[model samples]
Target: MAAFLEAVPARIRTLGAYQPGKSIRQAEQESGVSCIKLASNENPYGPSPLAVAAMQRELAGVNFYPDQDSLDLRAALATYAGVQPEQVLPTAGSSDLILLLLRLLLGPGSNAVGGDLSFFLYRIMTKSVGGTLKQVPMVNHAYDLDAIAAAIDHNTRVVLLANPNNPTGTLFTADEFERFLDKVPARVVVALDEAYSDYAEEFAVRRNVVWSRAFDYVRQGRNVLVLRTFSKAHGLAAVRCGWGAGPAELIGMLAKLRTLFSVSSVAQAAALAALGDLEHIHKSAIANAEGEAALSHALAEAGYPGVPTWGNFIFVETGEPALEVAAKLEKQGVIVRPMKAWGAPTAIRVSIGTSAQNELFLTAFRKVMPAH
Candidate 1:
């Protein structure tokens, strides 16, 4: 019998698919309760009011196709990113951009240097192309820039770093990045995935260390790309709109590879509207910071002090198996994420939910793990 699975590439066949946190609907079905989703690092506040209005208005045009070139959205994004329209490419969330970058850079005999503890998408995307993923171990849940620099060799074509990295929520400061950038070869493209950077602050703090810094390097023709999205701070996760800024030539190449009309018209409209509503983003940031602090305080009192987080999530150490602990919380309608997929079986990464959601999760934690 002919089998499609048998024909799959050896590398992809062996690789496990990327695992997202359990969806709210899926959790509700299992527990027969309204589940509080603290699994995926989603904004609890939801999308901006203006974005909602824009998407609603755009629904009438759904029968027609989206703007294939996405010119208007690109122009708006360029203004927001402080770059020229030719240098920014809108994508279907940052993940899409990540896949596109991986598709372009990786092929036979090519490899990328990345941290083992950073975003797992890099691992999946690299191997899907049969390219080697050189994973450098992290130090203190942050990118060990020195280790990443050391890992790059002759075959290294790309270096993937997660700014304010996921699962751990650690950050690589601007100064640390400049030092690392100095060490990287000119030929290697450094892909900085800064999806959570928006939550790190109010979109700007001109310290020469920012997504704009990478944008500056891009304009200078350096091989660099900064990946980000509306999903995090803007509360537009379901819209799936994201973007990247880089050299015009590089942006041209990515634009070429991007599927026609891949980003929906509604998403583009929503993103444009959301960009104008910075106040909503600021409120969401404040809520996330407060929720994270509350969670951290509870954990510290329980003797499980979590590592510092710059993003809207915290990594909590459970003295027992994290998966089991997460399961216990799930039974109580609390859905937090276990870190096994990120290589830490004894830790869980809980997204900062609303005040009520966080309290529910904290109460469930007390019932499940009970302090000593």
Candidate 2:
């Protein structure tokens, strides 16, 4: 029986599970202090007050199942992204949607292309669905679109590029994406993972520039999907609501595989309200941008090189092994994400928090690496 178990599909047997950041409570348990967690790029500001209020309103009807189609939320997202409601497919979160797309698009003998140091989940999902993971090495901590374009081959079924990539906090400009789009083959689906799009400086979540144009590719019969999430800006990571914008045919295929009622009634309600509250989203964006700038300046002044970031985080090259530095910071109640899993051994990716939390992280970082 043991030998039989070991003979499972080669894809499943060799696959590595996705490793998320340690929770603040876990950090506190390990360090014996109330920790400041700038690890996962979760919004430190809790969900918008409007979203919380809406969730409370829906609590009275907990017995009822949510609309499986996510009609209201999808409609709201369409309005938010300036697309028709048919183009939007809301899900439990972006992670689930990503897996769903991978399952629908790629399988054994196929491959998905993404940056080596971008989100690691893409590789995990691709491999889990029996697809080869083709990683193009990033140039100077940013997604090298030309290299990624060059890596695509005949077996490639999909291409996942995270604009304002995670862990690195680096972004692709509109022109860069245009150049890549001109070269990308029409046969494969290109997914621009814009989970942190709301946190960007120039491009707010609206119908403008590369963002709107990316979906236009889908509308023009090109296979492209733009992934977005409410987790970051809405601060609804707990609620776990997100969505995708793409061609109706592609979205419909993913929808067939999407788990019915995966999103709870409360989550749908909360996310609906979150989408409507643009003022609150604006405030959160401002806070993240300011926090990122302050952290970047501080890192520079302290003689540490940090990546130029448009998202709500800073990726710092710590010179020492990031895991060791992160472990040391853990002892001081600071939990920043180590990028070893993403093939960055000497870098720590810190999410933007409130001013007080940022100060705590900076203080801990200084203590961990003294002026030398």
Candidate 3:
């Protein structure tokens, strides 16, 4: 068994596991206070009422296996995205879809390009499939699409762009995205991850969905794959439903490689119902917008400045060790993600929470970081 396991490729042996934000349960066990987790950027408002009802309805059918094709959910998503059913493939979550894309496109000798400050999962997934990974440094906390395109080489097969990027909570403009797409070679696939796209607001414009532009580009023969999640907007993170949209052929190939019953029956029903709950989505958006402002103002008052966020989180530079600050915050029952993992040592990313939770974290932060 040892010899067999050791036969694994050197690249696989050297891989580091992806680090997700610590759970509230872990924080509660450590801090002794029921933790107010502002980590992971999950929807604080939770799943829509309709989604809960749908899940409850499916509870009696737990013994039945889920649909291997997730046909109903895919059809519902196609309706929501205004794309053909063939263009959409629903997975357990967007993360699974991303992994499937990498697996389908990447292999030994092929390289992948991704923003250094974007979702860390992109790097992990690309490397896991033996793809050489190139990291493009972000400009002003936003994904530098030019840098990403420039890094692409002949061997590059995929480019992963996480919009409204995690940890940093920044985004690329439409013009910049178009320029990047134009520069990318036809042989390579461009994956646009819109996990938090629902919360993204345009510069000087109101918040609205922008994924249609991505899909339109794909429809025009571009090798673009767009990913979205029910996690953030629909508050179905626990349910784990997400999908990808692109050419039918590309989606078909990915679908073939995906495991059977990737999404549970309950999850599919919950996602379908959540898609129709426009009111809940609106409430979550409003909560996130207000929470972002509140957190930013609180950070400023505490003498730490925060990055402008279009998602349900803010990245703030604390002028101190992020790990230490995070530890301090954790002790106070406010769990946040430190940016050290992303090589931003002086920054800590805080997920926007309810007003009460925000005030609690602010008070705790002030106490831990009193004026010298």
How do the residues 219-290 of candidate 1 rate in per-residue lDDT, one tens digit apiece? 676778988899988999999999999888888888889988889999999999998998998889877777
The RMSD of every model to the true structure, in order and in angstroms, is 2.1, 2.3, 1.9
TM-score per prediction, in order, is 0.95, 0.95, 0.95
lDDT of each: 0.85, 0.85, 0.85
Off by over 4 Å in 3: 201-212, 370-372
Q: Estimate the TM-score for candidate 1.
A: 0.95
RMSD of 1: 2.1
What is the TM-score of candidate 2? 0.95
Question: Alpha-carbon error at 3 in model 3, in Å?
Answer: 2.7
